[model samples]
Target chain A: MRDRIIEIIGTHGKNQGALIPVLKAVQRMNPRQYIPQEASQLVARIMGLRESEVYEVVSFYGEFSETPRAEHVIKICDSTVCRVNHHRELVDILEHTLGIRVGEASRDGKFFLEYSPCFGACDVAPALRIDDKVYGNLDRDKLEAILEAYRR
Target chain B: MKKNVALITENFHHYIPPDLAGYKHFGGFTALKKALALSEEDLIERIEDSGLRGRGGAAYPTGKKMRQSKAYQDDIKYLICNADEGEPGTFKDRDLLEQDPFGVLEGMVITAYAVGATHGILYLREEYAHLLELLQGAMAAMRREGLLGQGILGTALDFDMTIFSGAGAYICGEGTSLIESMEGRPGRPRNKPPYTKAQGLYLKPTLVSNVETFSAITAIVKHPQGVFTGYGTQKSPGTKLISLCGNVNNPGTYEVPFGLTLEEIITELGHGVAGDKGIKFVQVGGISGPLLPRACLKMPLTYEDFDAEGLSIGSGAVLVVDEDTDILDFLDAVAAFFKHESCGKCTPCREGNRQLMNILKRMREGTALPSDPENIQRIAHTMKYASFCGLGKTAPTALLSAIKYCPEEIFMRRGQ
Candidate 1:
């Protein structure tokens, strides 16, 4: 996680094309890790691009993170129509099985969760993401099984 | 656990009428039936007293706009329902327009009567064509039953609604931009102060409300003088509809009270993270919202929650950035999008976003000076100060917020 962040910081100083590649390289390391603050300015000087360009790229998308996250973060899709699709049931099952509520980390620090407005997966109706994996049509049983992976 | 909040699904599994017969069976328009009994001015007063705000991204007071438009000079006032779901992480309005069309229609018609608008328009996003069609069919159904167009249920309120779809432009979601688009102009935003109440759409007085905001008014119509005993906190009441997605066992839409904490929302509503890999951080309230560390999840999901986190409660967007995920590239993608979308209306936003992207690129490619952090901060601050519209002003929010949270990773030296 740390190495990738460093590598990306190196790329932000290159030409314009290097911006995305550097970022992608860092993302490959770990979405949860903090990106070094100097990466943007370095990128601008190297690529002959403006610092604002780097800022825009970093801020516009939902995937980037600038800090370290908890051991587990849960995001539930709660779009207006998703409410009708039983997103509540998913939240309820996960919350109950884990014995914790949304946005709350488990007592043992095994889990953390919250509601997400959208993940761009509407066809599945009710779907989920475990780390980077997407799981659809999940119930309490599936949810529990999924959580078991992190028990290690 | 919080005494159970109602998650009224506008576009979930099913909440609308298959036919007029079905609508009446389900209590559709009962609010209108009750609201039609009062004078338009009286209806406005009730809404004002209710202290309701628009559900769109702006969160402006609904009744205040209605009251102001009441005195505009022209009789040709317009009531535009902004069903344009342009925001990337937001799809709430489409849910209401597609599933619970009547709920939104009842509210819009009543609003039309109150604001003295003869014409109503639903400015929808092109991506939601299927939803738009569903709404059109509902409108035709409403007209067939005499519920719309010149008097209904023996009342004398005359209003007509039409759907005008917008081409792809996220900026159009802005109220003034929507007005400009509706009037056959470029979808760029105008300066505030004159506001939509004083001059909107065809240069006449106009009142614009989002799809969900208008639908809530239907609930208001039913209650009229009735009051909601207890619900959300003082500033924001009633249940809020949210689309939850990303890194959870259950990723979909649900409703909860206003002050729900991020922790409670995910654990209770979203279940736990899908995989045990662990959650490192969260981006609540979408792109314009703040990027939060796991530490802040315990706070309530209200305006206060955002303020405490140094973030904004934007458009009800809540996203999760799971463990072992890359923060730089994700930021890179966001930067690229802004570079493409910046209207270039102002030099600061136009040039600032571009320069930031360049700097980010150089950093990613290992080509910038050691002082990249200071440069990034200087430009980000400039964009915040000089951008003309919310699009520009808030564009750097996520990046800056993330930087504040994780300056080490963002500023890490490669050779070290």
Candidate 2:
């Protein structure tokens, strides 16, 4: 892990502007999908910056998480377009299917459901993003089928 | 009479993914070739004559902005394409990149030549992560064809581009805030005076424009003079790509000339409200844009017309709301968005959003005092005048417009 982090930093260089991309690459490589305390400290030392600065960057953006996240993060659209299209019902179905409320990972560590601002998928209202793929115009069956595929 | 005008979107359906040959077959890089032959001053003047404005809400003259950057004497000036299309109810940029990536790239190269910029960066949002491979392939193809990197098409110009992904911050759509985020800090807006053209990315003379704006430049340079300006009204020339969403029956991206009324856009283009529902009101532009009642639909979709009614054609997102949805419920969603997306840098925005959300919540619960509406107005005005950035200043746009346009529907719910 240490060597990999160093290699990532080397590829992007030790510039301050390269911090976000480096951290993103590090977090994506982690098994738990988060930047652990040790990784942040190591990044700080190598980049010649304070540990707090690294942690602040991690905590500030919605994408980065310090603690462990589920293997797949389910981000439901909660903006005006989706809400007008009744995204609340989508949230209800998501919470019931996953058997965990929003902001919580499933007991088996498979899924974590949360809300995201509109991601320019408004054409298909009531959309959700799992990993990099976006699914929209959802109903109960479609939602269940999507989660089933991810669960497998 | 024509519902769709295909200028930037002319070859949208023809090209396959990353098909450089197909893009050329449809007359793609010919504009760059023509632009390369002209002096920088002539190119800028032609763009100015076309009357093309910034497509990303502000509507500043694109040619004027390019001329301003050209005045500065910098060895390493940067041209940053703001692809951070985080605006709610907007997906036109995503469509353009997906269908016509080469047009956008061609525009970037032409703009770089005009401004004498060596480095170009496409600030893509994280949500559009799926398009990364396609863009990379397109750039690689451009390089192979001598369209990008070190002496483009046997010219002395040398320019290159790279993609930088934003980590989900709507405020980063602001020019300075986007630059700040690129600098690896928290995505917060900086004080303006040395605007982005003077001192931008890495404190250099950088020119930041939206993805659609770059594509428009490509279109303007492609055709003969007065041909591109033939569409739309006298003040606002050329076509606009509108992301029509919400309760519209046919919700999608449409490229329309600027003279059509909102009613025509909603009815003829969008196929009217979904499920045959009656119209309640429309939110022109994105979430930050003002909400207009049905009566205002008669106004044409021009910058001058919208400006006359104290509204701007921001982002070209026309979000139609049906009569089935309540106005206050809609405002709640709008309030929640600002509260969540605020960078919390300044007091007026950070605290003002919290207060606005609280008051909206109380009003929804029917627990408001008579002073609540007045208080909401006061807080909104304060945030408008005092907030540090565009996010805070325009945060209360929807709420204030609700009060102004739909006062009876909103205050009646309070039984006042």
Candidate 3:
């Protein structure tokens, strides 16, 4: 873990502005999809910054999560465009399919559902992003198919 | 019966992205070639004459920003393409970046040359992280063909660009906050006066522009001397990429001239509301922009017209809400967005958005408080005036505009 973290830091360098990218890479590397305490401390030590500074950035942005998450994070769009398109129905379907609420990870830890601001997918309203990819114009069946693929 | 003009989006549906050969075939880097031949002063002057404004919500004069960045005497200057399209209904920037990646890159290189910027950063929002591979592939092709890095087209100029991902902060869309986030800090807006032009992105002269603005710059440079100015009104020259969405038949990005009415945009371009539903109101720009009722649909989609009506063509997003949608529901979403996105840097925004959300929630829940509507206005006004940055200042625009356009909807519930 130390060697991989060191390798990530080596690529980004120990520059002042390299912290955000480094932390993001570290979070992506973790299987649980979070920046664990040890990883944050390691990043702080290698980047020549205090632990609070690292944690401050982690807590500030919506992308980073300190606690462990499911294998995939699903961010639903609850903004105006999506709301007008009845995103709540999609949210209900997501909860029913995953058997978890909006802010909870599935029982098997396959998916975590949370609300997100508009991610520029308004053209395809009622959009949700899974990890890096966005799925929009979603109906219940399409969403279930997507989750099924991720479940496997 | 005017048709949608296709300047920046001309090559959108024509070819698949990351295809360098196809992009060049569509006359991609001809602007860079044209811009390189002209002197820096000439390039800046042409931009000034073109009358292009920032496509991001601010609508600041793009030429003036470039000239200001150029005026600063600095060894290292940065040009950041603000692709943080977090504005609720604004997705035109994403479309431009995805469809015409080369055009945006060409514009950045030209602007870097004009402003004497040493390095450039494409500050892409993390939401669009899927586009990183395509953009990187396009950049790699440019580098292979001698279009990026060191000398470009065998000239004395040297400029290179890299992508910087934003970590889900809406306030970072502001120039200073963006710089702060890039410098590995919390994405919070900094105090101005030492503006980005004087000191930005590691405290050097920087030029931050929207993604669509850069695409427009490429078009302006490619066809100089009134050719680009032939479109749009006298005050607002050139077309705007309108992200038409929400309860509409065609919810997509359309590039249209400035003087067209919102009615035409909603009816002709958007094919009216979804299912032929009657229109209730339209929110031009993003969530921060004003909410215009159906009566105001006759108003032209120009900066001057919007400004005359005490509104702006913010982010060029036209959110058409049908009569089926409730005003309180819309306002609740708007309030909730600001509350969630407030960086908590200042009291007015951090607390004001909270109070606004609370009041709206109560209003939605039928909790009786006659003072809630007035209190909502009071808090919104405070946030508008006393908040630290543009986020806090413009945060209450939808709430305030809701009161102005649909007072009965807000006050009726409260029995006021």
Could you say which candidate leads in lDDT? 2
TM-score of 2: 0.98
Better of 1 and 2 by TM-score: 2
Tens-place lDDT digits, model 3, residues B84-166 = 98898999989998889888999999999999999989999988999999899988999999999999999988999999988
Strongest candidate by DockQ: 3
Query: How far off is each candidate at the interface, as Cα RMSD in Å?
Result: 12.3, 0.8, 0.7
Judge candidate 3 at residue B233 and give its lDDT.
90
Return whichever of 2 and 3 wins on DockQ.
3
DockQ ranking, best first: 3, 2, 1
Q: What lDDT tens digits, residue by residue, belong to model 1 across residues B267-290?
A: 778787767547666666655666
lDDT (Cα atoms) of all candidates against the true structure: 0.67, 0.91, 0.90
List pairs with backbone clashes in candidate 3.
Answer: none
What order do you get sorting by TM-score, best first?
Answer: 2, 3, 1
RMSD of 3: 1.3
Q: By the DockQ metric, which is better: model 1 or model 2? A: 2
CAPRI verdict (incorrect, acceptable, medium, high) for model 3: high
DockQ score of each predicted structure, in the order shown: 0.03, 0.85, 0.89
DockQ of 2: 0.85
